[model samples]
Target: MIVSLAISGYRSLRNLILPLGRLTVVTGANGSGKSSLYRSIRLLADVAQGRAISSLAREGGLTSTLWAGPEIISRAMKQGEVPVQGGARRSSVSLKLGFADEDYGYAIDLGLPQSDSTSYFNYDPEIKVESLWAGEALSRHNQIAGRSGPSVKVLDSHGHRVPVLQTLASFDSMMTHAADPKDALELLVMRERMRSWRFYDHLRTDREAPARVPRIGTRTPVLSSDGADLAAALRTIQEIGDPVQLEEAIDDAFPGARIEITVTDGLFEVLMHQSGLLRPLRASELSDGTLRYLLLIAVLLTPRPPPLLVLNEPETSLHPRLLDPLARLVTQTAERTQIILVTHAQTLASQLSGCEGCLHFELRKELGETVVDGVEPPRWAWPKR
Candidate 1:
């Protein structure tokens, strides 16, 4: 479980540190940087997959995502005594993201690429520094591995510093490059843990949504990010996972309604058996809200849960009456996996307020920077470039 998360110089998040629990609910008003925080976490996950540079490019590159406000918002500016203004540069441009569980922590720093005449991808972001440490907090003595520029180093068995590799590409991450069992075993473990992190954002329920159509059946233990394999996943759960919990989740949302799967020629489709209906309704005939609810059930009740699961606005297209059941499902799933939910619905947030072992955070913009309400910022130190 991640105990803490930190981000700096990303959009409205000039400097922010958040404490995380088993089930963390991040809520705020519109334009309060909720989406930016979600994307930042996704960017961290992309690093483990060696797609961090490309992910930033898809968001318009480093400069476009960098914080637009002044580097520092002084008390004078806050008091309206002086207008906020930028002074002479005091530090290099940096965008950082990191998280830590009870036993491990990892952080990465990205900066502008050096001036190069031979490369066409000069605008690309480069990994300036990366650190992987043991225990809850990062310290000089606890760092197991470190990456600076193109060089990588790790602690030997005798606790002596040994160079692991050189010539690591700036666009690549150490998680992808330093996978040697002899020199950097910790890197491999950290990489796999990060790769297991799952995210779901805006599952489609439109007329042509993939979940609505029949797809070739496979024993799916994990639901796809787009929920395209929802039927197979739910079916797999019923056969191999906790079928009772699945049934309870469905009944909790819609009483006397059960889900059925029909497989023909290896194609799997979902069917619904509801009260007061002569014939069962197919996935295509189910309402948008009902389809989305089923998708959430399949996700939360997965037989194989990831180490971390993130849901961006699971309440989308859901009616107010369904929020309580959805919240209950999320709360129950958090017991087996660390979950972060970013929502814009007060009803959903309120529904989760009474859940045990859940953390609540309301983000708000202060002088164009995102800050957590009623919480002190955690102490954080980044590796120098």
Candidate 2:
């Protein structure tokens, strides 16, 4: 489990440190940078997969995503722009993100590339620094794996340097590259951990959404990002996973309404049995709220839970009455894996906070920077360069 997370120079999240728990809820106003914090976590995961650049490109270029605030501040400068403001950058333009897990921690630093004349991918950010330490939750102690630009090195189990030094490409991550498997064991472990960090953001329930359409059945232990195979996922859970929890969750949400997945020929479909209905309704015929609620169920109660699960804006289409059921479901699911819910709904946040075990972080903007409410500065020490 991730105990603490730190992000700097990413969007409006300038130097923000947040403590995590079994279930962490992040709530704030529209522009308080809740979404930015969520995406930064996603990007940190991307970095370990060597897809950090791809993820940043998808968000926009790195320059556009970096913080836009002034490099330094002063009392008079706070009032107005200083005349002698040289605009000299104090530190290297770096967007750093990392998290401290149970026994290890990992951090990555990305910066703008040196002016490349011929390369068309000049806008791409380059990995400047990456580190994975053993247990320095308070200080920079054991150096398990460390990288500086192209030069990469690793520490053996005995905390000694490996014989074979390695070189990594500017565009690639030390986690992806590096020769000799045993040399970078921590990096490899960190990479796999990051890849296991699952993210679900706004699963659609529109008229033409894939969750409402029929798809081929298969043994789906995990739901897809688009949630197109909702039936197969739920059916797989009922067959191999905890079917009682699945049924009870559904019944808890809709009273007597239970879910059943049907497979005709090769296509998979969903039949929702609700009370007072003459006949069970199909997935395509069910209301948007019902389909979305099932999707949430399918996501939370997975047979194979990831190391961390992130749900963004899950309360978008859910009715106010269903919030309690959803909150109950999430609180129950937290027993299996770590969860971070980034939401805009105060009611859902409040309800989840009132749950048995949940750590809530209310984000607020202070001088254009996002900070957790009532958190003392430097309460959580970050892994620094």
Candidate 3:
């Protein structure tokens, strides 16, 4: 499980370190940088998939996502004695992200690309440094792999640095290019673990949502990010997964209601069997809240649970009455997987207040930077460029 998360120079994150538990609930007012923190985690996962550069470009590149505030918010500025303003940068322009579990830690540094006349993608950021180390904290003695600029190196059996590559692209990640099952087995293991992380944000339940359309039947152990395979996912659970838990989750949300899947011409569709109804309701006929709730059920009860699962604003469009059931489902899922829930609903947070292995954080903005009070930040170290 990830014990700590560190992000710097990313939007409102500025320099933030957050401790994590088995079930971490991050709650805060709007504009308190909740979404930024969520996206930073996604960015880290993208690195393992070799999509980090493209993901940053899709978010309007480094300039748009970098912190806009001053390098230092001085005491005089906080006292209102002087206006907050930027000064000559004392360091290079860089954005850093990292996370650490009990066994290992990883960090990456991204900076502005060097001036090049041969390329036009100047807005694209270059990865300056990457490090993978042992234990929860990074130290030179525990470093297993290190990359500087275009060169990559790994530790040998004698704990000596062995050069692996001299031409690794700046847009690529060592997690993808330098991992060797023979020489760098640790990199391969860590890479796959990071790739197993899953994220869900703003699942659509509109009239044209994909979940409403019938799709070909296939055995699905994992729900797609868009929930396009909702029927297959639910059917998989009923077949090989914990069917009792799925049914209980449904009944807990809507008393006496259950789920059914119908197939016609090899196309599968979801149907809801509820009390006091003449017939079951099709996925397209169900209300937005009902469909969204069902999607969450399919996600949380996945047969193949990921190492990490992140849900952003899952309470959206959910009724107040359903918050308790949702909280119960989340806590149950956390037993098998690590979960990070970012929510704006105090009711949901209250429901999970005293659950086992649960940690709660309330974020707020201070001088345009996100801050969390009353909890000690976890020990973390970032790889230098």
Candidate 4:
């Protein structure tokens, strides 16, 4: 589980450290940097996948994502004695993202390209530093993999830093370059663990949504982000997973309504068998709420849960009446996997207020910088560069 995440110089987040838990809910007002925080986490995951630059390019380049406010605010500015004015930056600008866990920790730093030549791809971001450490957090006992500029080093059995590769490409990461199973076994493990981290942003359930159409049946242990194979996923759960939870979830949302999957000539369809209804309604005829509830059930009650699961605004388009059941499903999922939920809904945050082992992080803008409300420095010790 991720215990903490630290981000700096990204959008409105000047320098903020967030404490994570098994169930962490991040909530904030509009323009309070909630979405920025979510995107930052995604960027970190992209680094592990060796596509961080490509991911940022889709976001209108690095300049647009960088913090737009001044580098530093003077004491007089804080006291309202002087107007805000631009000045020379005191330090080089770099976007940093990192997280610490009980087993290991990883961090990546991104900055501008060295040569600003006139080229079509000059806006591409470059990785400046990447580090993978061991133990509960990054400390003296840690430092497994460290990369500085174009040089790479790894810790030996005798706890000595031995240079593995001296000259690496600027665009390529050591993690990707050293993924051979025979050599750099630790890198392979780290890559696999990092890849297991799943993220779901939005799922469409409109008139023409794919979940409405019957898909060819196949075993599905995981719900795809698009939810195209929802029926197969649910059927997979019923056959190989906890079917009782699936039934209870459907009955919890809609009393006397049971979910059934019908297969005909390799095509599979999902239906809701409600009481007092002569004929069950197909997925295409079910209400948006009903379909969305089923999708959540398939996701939360998965047979194979990942190490970390991130859901960004799962309450989107959901009615207030359904928030209770949705919250219950989220809490149930947290019991198996670490869940990071970012939501703008105050009701959802309030509903999860007294959840045991849950940490609530409320981000607020402090002088144009993202800060955890009422949190002071030294709350957690960060690894030294």
The top-ranked prediction according to lDDT is 3
Q: Candidate 1: what lDDT?
A: 0.91
Better of 3 and 4 by lDDT: 3
Give the RMSD in angstroms, all C-alphas superposed, for model 4: 2.1
lDDT of each: 0.91, 0.83, 0.94, 0.82
Whole-model alpha-carbon lDDT for candidate 2: 0.83
> Per-residue lDDT of 178-281 in model 2, one digit per residue for the tens?
62465676677778888999999968899998988888989998999888989999999998999999999998899998877888889999998888998999
Ranking by lDDT: 3, 1, 2, 4
User: Going through the candidates in order, what is the number of backbone clashes in each?
Assistant: 0, 0, 0, 0
- Where is the poorest 10-residue window by lDDT in model 1? 376-385
- With a 3 Å backbone cut-off (N, CA, C), the pairs that clash in candidate 3 are none
**Per-residue lDDT value at 67 in model 1:** 95
**How displaced is residue 152 in candidate 1, in Å?**
0.5
User: Model 4 residue 23 lDDT?
Assistant: 94
* Model 1 alpha-carbon drift over 4 Å, by segment: none
Better of 1 and 4 by lDDT: 1
Give the RMSD in angstroms, all C-alphas superposed, for model 1: 0.9
Q: Which residue pairs show backbone clashes in model 4?
A: none
Candidate 2 colliding pairs, count:
0
Deviating ranges (above 4 Å) for candidate 3: none
Q: Distance from true position, residue 377, model 4, in Å?
A: 5.9
